[model samples]
Target: MKSRTYTLVIIALAAALTAGCASVAERDSRDPLESMNRAVFSFNEGVDKAVVKPLAKGYKTALPRLVQNGIRNVFSNLDDATEFANNLLQFKIQAASSDLMRVAVNSSFGFMGLFDIATEMRLQKHNEDFGQTLGRWGFANGPYLVLPIFGPSSFRDGLGLAVDSHFTDPVYQIKDVASRNDALGLQLIGQRADKMDALAALEEAALDKYEFTRDFYLDRRAGLVYDGRPPASE
Candidate 1:
């Protein structure tokens, strides 16, 4: 099932790339698939409103702040492993060593990462991923894309996500299928809950939410690729 799903995603991305060439006047240079992306963005908003947002609200309401923090920490600890790998791929040895130590300290002294002892100990947390690594290796960012249920992404990041999900994500590596799925669901809900306030503010402030999201995603990704110092031309 996972293989089939991955295959479908690859096919969809390929199709999107090919179909995006249909020219539209006044389209943003970074998003030739504006029409398709907007439709997908609308669909994502509908799903979020009807299901994800409500669930996230309930999750926030039911969980104590400490519990939420702990859950977030645990997930962050798991992500450290991915960061470590990507840092190594990018030849960021110092950052990779920090990431490795973070996973070790958090997993052990932090009690399965329910506490972030590493951060308290002055070890900086890094967020590296396959996408940024690819960028460091000089891969171009293709058209902006809005994936169904996944929100903002681009061609390069979409491919990075696929690679991470299949290869690097610790949560996806759980041996038990049920446990892996539960972890995935919990992580999604936690992330959505965490972003509720920021997203609400965005919705209220932005005149064109879709454009704002796309630009923000692109700019932020570019910064990540260049270690917060994107080229002036970008």
Candidate 2:
């Protein structure tokens, strides 16, 4: 069943990429599915407003700042394992080593990652994932896509997301279904709460929120792929 699901995802992503290329001449070159994307974006906005934003707000109100930070740190520490794997895949030995060290220090001295002792000890934190690994592997960022609930993505990154979620995400690897879901929910709420201020600023400032977000996401991904020094053409 899992193999079948993975096959279906690969097929769907390939079809989307092909369709995007075929329609590029009729729409924005980067966002060939602009109409469909806009609809999904609207749906995501509604869900965020009705469900996610309220939960995030309530979460922030209920938790002390220290507790919130601790939760964030714990998740961040777990994410270091993913980073380590991706960095190794990308052949970034230094980064992979640092990530491994961070995990070890934070998990032991920081009380199972409730605190970030690694950072204090001068070990830099790196944000790496299968998406960036695929990018580094020379996969083109296909047409821009707006995923329901997940928001902005691209064909390549979408596939990368599937791979990472299925194979590398520590939370997703939890053996207990209910516990996994609870952890996932907490992580989502915590992330949303952290981004509330930035989201509010974007809402207030952007003339076209969708375009702004899409452009920012694509640009940021490109920068990440190129290690903050994208080629002039990008």
Candidate 3:
């Protein structure tokens, strides 16, 4: 159920990215790839105006309690493993080691579901997401790609999606066809839901929404590669 919802959410989001940039493409006559990029941004803008913003608002209006947040934490724990792996691959030894400890302790305590018990065990969750992993591996931000329906992403980050799907995902382990897909999709949507509200707030007051989004995406990608610790000055 949750997974299926999440799948649609992914589709919807991909469309959003593409569509959001489409309008910009129309105004600026660029090369073939740039035109495509614009179209994606156009589509994402529309989805934001329509679906993404509303879903985010609805979620925020009804806050979860400690118990529910705990459960959400548990489910999110499964993802920490992959994040750990990616961090190691990207050369963030300290954070990667921390995630490994998290997975070990959580799995031992049956908190593999990430039930916040891991925190009590002193296993902190180091924030990790896929796009950042790609940047560290020498992939240039190919182009600012507004993925139609997917919302904001660059060509580089877009490829990151495939990396995450292939390596980080544990969905393949789910036995039941319906349940597995449902769970996977739900997770994706849930994460998206968490971000939508913040994004909406930021976008609402931006001067040049497109440029703002473009710069924002790049800045975030760079920040992630360096694990929020800015590089040392020369």
Candidate 4:
């Protein structure tokens, strides 16, 4: 249910952002979404400082290889979804077929997690989404946006999230409310935990974290648009 709720919220956000696009240029620099993004960043930073770092140390301190394997599987699973969607959107029938094969094989053998054997079979993970594909074929991103609690996105991506939610794992379809919330929190925490190294690097290297995130987001979005093609230099 977490994914569904997230989807619904994203759809509502997409509608709001698209409908309010006309006024964004006129709005103050302190837009709510931007403010919320910054706030979440700061909050996440605090989380890292107070919680994530110590836990990472403890995890490494306790069960190093186990943590490593779990993280590997988690991201690998995500790649399957992305690769499959991208291939379908790009109209690459062969690639899409490979993606489905990977999905099916992994879902059963790997127990709903990606094993990354597909990449070894020469099929790469391609970035994609229904909205990005639509954008590439004709639809626009609609607007630059930073969705509340969801981070950076466009109206198109927000819609894509809504669509993508249906294919999410069983964790998203749990009927019990409290259990769903707990699962969602655990999932987000795990995702964030995996990003610790990246965050550390960004904190040290980037002159402007906001610019770094924005540029990175846009560049990543461009990858989705061009079906994994590298973006031209600005």
Best by lDDT: 1
Residue 228 lDDT, candidate 2, scale 0-100: 100
Q: Candidate 2: which stretches are off by over 4 Å? A: 1-27
Model 4 scores worst on lDDT over the 10 consecutive residues at: 24-33
lDDT of each: 0.87, 0.85, 0.62, 0.62
lDDT of 2 by residue, 69-143 (tens): 999999999999999999999999999999999999999999989999999999999988888898899888877
lDDT of 1 by residue, 92-142 (tens): 999999999999999999999999999999899998888888899989887
lDDT of 4 at 161: 63
- Which candidate model has the greater TM-score, 1 or 2? 1
Winning candidate number (TM-score) = 1
Q: What is the TM-score of each candidate against the true structure?
A: 0.95, 0.91, 0.69, 0.70
lDDT per residue as tens, model 3, 179-199: 877666555456666676576
Residue pairs with backbone overlap in model 1 = none
- lDDT of each residue in 17-128, candidate 4, tens digit only: 5556545443333233454445545665676678757766565546566666665665566556665775676687787787788777666676665355555666555555
TM-score winner between candidates 3 and 4: 4
- Tell how far residue 173 is off in model 1, in angstroms: 1.0
| Pairs that clash in candidate 4 | 1-172
Q: Judging by TM-score, tell me the better candidate of 2 and 3.
A: 2
